[model samples]
Target: MDIFSNLWLGASTAFMPMNLFYGFIGCLLGTAIGVLPGLGPTATIAMLLPITFGLPPESALIMLAGIFYGAQYGGSTTAILINLPGESSSVVTAIDGYQMARNGRAGAALATAALGSFFAGTVATILLAVAAPPLAAVALNFGPAEYFSLMVLGLVASVALASGSLLKAFAMIVFGLILGTVGTDVESGTPRYVFDIPELYDGLNFVAVSMGIFGICEILRNLEGEHERSVGVKRVTGLMLTRQDIKRIIAPVLRGTALGSFLGILPGGGAMLASFASYAMEKRISPNRAEFGKGAIEGVAAPESANNAGAQTSFIPMLTLGIPGNPVMALMVGAMIIQGITPGPNVISDEPALFWGMIVSMWSGNLMLVILNLPLIGLWVKMLTVPYHLLFPAIIGFCCIGAYSINNSVFDVFVMAGFSVIGFALSKMRFEPAPLLLGFILGPMLEENLRRAMLISQGDPSIFVRSPLSLSLLIFAVVVLALVLSPSISRKREEAFTE
Candidate 1:
């Protein structure tokens, strides 16, 4: 009953003319970013963060939230149309989606992706509304020790989730953590790793590093093979799915939604995990599993739906626990903090309108994305015809602008360029950047909580095991780590890598 009343209030708030307009604008911009290679919701939102300062908190958040999830909708368009993935989550989609396009089933692929995403998003949003409160209550009991253990678990899970060698992933994570320490120490007021650069005192800007690594590095990679690239052009025959397509997709979409909704609530789970897990699940369960990488409709439907559902439900952890599951969610947390809104359990009880309003806006935004993306599919496909020479320069320009705008520092531009080179080098070495980014984002928080726990225990490390919750979390982390490093698990991991 109370949930219904809160939802009604949320509907009322979200339906306001101003909020609705912002939601539409957000969806539009998000789709544009997603369609364009190298520009993601995180970069887009970071660029627009300053503009949101003038708007009311609810309206600002609604629009920002819209952009986050709407990107998932637009990302699949590029994945299907071209072999290029607009987002990391769309990588799996591109495997079968591009195959479908090559097989002259682009229309069917697009339709399945759109319809599956809509269905999954709707179900996930409902699950979020129902599950967030209980999750928040659980989080409210976390002391410093528990939080430290949770952070360790998150970091370990993230490293295990990386696509490459576990040792390489751990190395990248350690590098990121070391890089995260290059600023003024919060407790001692001592500067470390600054090397006497004034800008270094503030640490590396997340925007600069993220944009440099993702955006600029992508541009450089694309440019290297520009001459060899053939623009994937396919005739648009139809846009609607056939009855057979629908029959094949319904089960995958439902399964994806269930999997994504649950996984997305975990501390380190987000769209990428959702998509990857969905693909693995579909392959295991599908009758025609061998067809998975060969334009299977289930392949297009399952991961597409799962990524969207995960994107929507990821907000639950960010909003209710003040713990971001990914860099994109971390940026949302930054935006919330900028608006003077502290995200935690009390947010629901204290700021019901903001909480519920954001929830309602997610559904509204999903509806808007479906409507907007259907017609814009042709336009997005046409964008692929734009030459790489022209697009690469524009992308670099945006990367520079985004980095500079983060702190209004020209130094950030230099930082971006430096990281771009480093990212390219890392890519050449076969190291994945995503886990490193995750480590950089979580490292400081983990350290802070660990230090606080130690202080509370008067430097007694045994305090970590004294608390039951903390002990359990630590045990889980250790067990997972042990399993990941075991000989049997290593053999399977090597097989996956070889594949």
Candidate 2:
């Protein structure tokens, strides 16, 4: 009964005139960014963070969250049409989606991606509404020691799950941590690595680094090829799905939603991992595994659905526990903090409207994405035809705008360009970017909590082991590290790392 009442309240908040408009705008913007290569939800939201200063916290969050999942819907369009993934999560979609486009089944693939995402997103939102409160309650019991250990476990899990050489991932993580330390020291109030630049006082902006690495680097890479201007010529027609398509997709969608929901709860398990994992699982379990990588409808459905589910449920940790599961979620936490809304267990009880409003907005945003993406499929496909030369310049222009918008500082633009060079070098060296992102996002929190724990324990390091929960978490981290470094895993890791 309480849940029903909360749902009603949430719906009412979501349906309000102003909030509805914001949700629509967010969905539209998210789709646009998603269709365009380089500009992802993370960079987009960070760019818009300043603009949300005047809006209500709930409305701001609704729009930001919309952009996050709406990208999932729009990303598949590019993946299917051009074999280019607009978002990292959509990379797996390209495997089957592009194959379908090549096979003259672009329409079916688009329809499946859109419908599967909508179904999964809707189900995941409901699950989030039901599951978040209990999880938040459990989180309230955690102390500084537990938090520190949990972060250790998260970092270990991220490294384990990443698709590359463990050593490379570890190196990238260490690099990110070092980058994260460029600003003033939080505890000592002393400068560390600023090198005397006025802008360096605040540290390396997340927006600048992310935009440079993702947006600018993508443009530079795309410009190196002559065929960049040639757009995909695949034709799409019809919206109706065949009965066989429906039969093949239903089971995959269900399985994908389950997998995505679970993974989404883990730190670093963002939409990209969910989508790729879903595709891999579907291929491994399906009797027609031979059809995978060859335009299988199940391949499109499972990953598309899982990506959306993961996008939605990833909010669980951010909203309920104040622990961001990914960089984008960390930005959302920053937004919440800016609004004076501390995200934690009390958020649900003390601010039900905010919590429920955000939940309802997710459903609204998902619906908007479906409605917007279906008819616009042809238009998005047409965009793929834009010459790479012209498109790359436009992407570069937007990257500059996105970087400057974060803090309205030109310094960020330079930072982005710097990171672009670094990212390109790293790519050349075969280092995975995702693990680095995870490290950049977690490093500060890890250090902050570690310091706090030590302070509380009067410099006694044994405090970590004194708490059974923390001790167990540390043990788990060590085990995961061992497994990732094992010889059996090293061979497989080499193959993934080669890309």
Tell me the tens digit of each residue's lDDT in model 1 across 80-135: 88788787788889889989988889888888888888888888878878988887
Query: Measured by TM-score, how close is model 1 to the native structure?
Result: 0.89
Candidate 1, run of 10 with poorest lDDT: 490-499
* Residue range with the least summed lDDT across 10 consecutive positions in model 2: 490-499
Off by over 4 Å in 1: 40-60, 98-104, 195-197, 227-235, 288-294, 487-499
TM-score of each: 0.89, 0.89
Query: Cα RMSD for candidate 1?
Result: 3.0
* Cα lDDT, all candidates: 0.80, 0.82
Residue 37 accuracy (lDDT) in model 1: 63
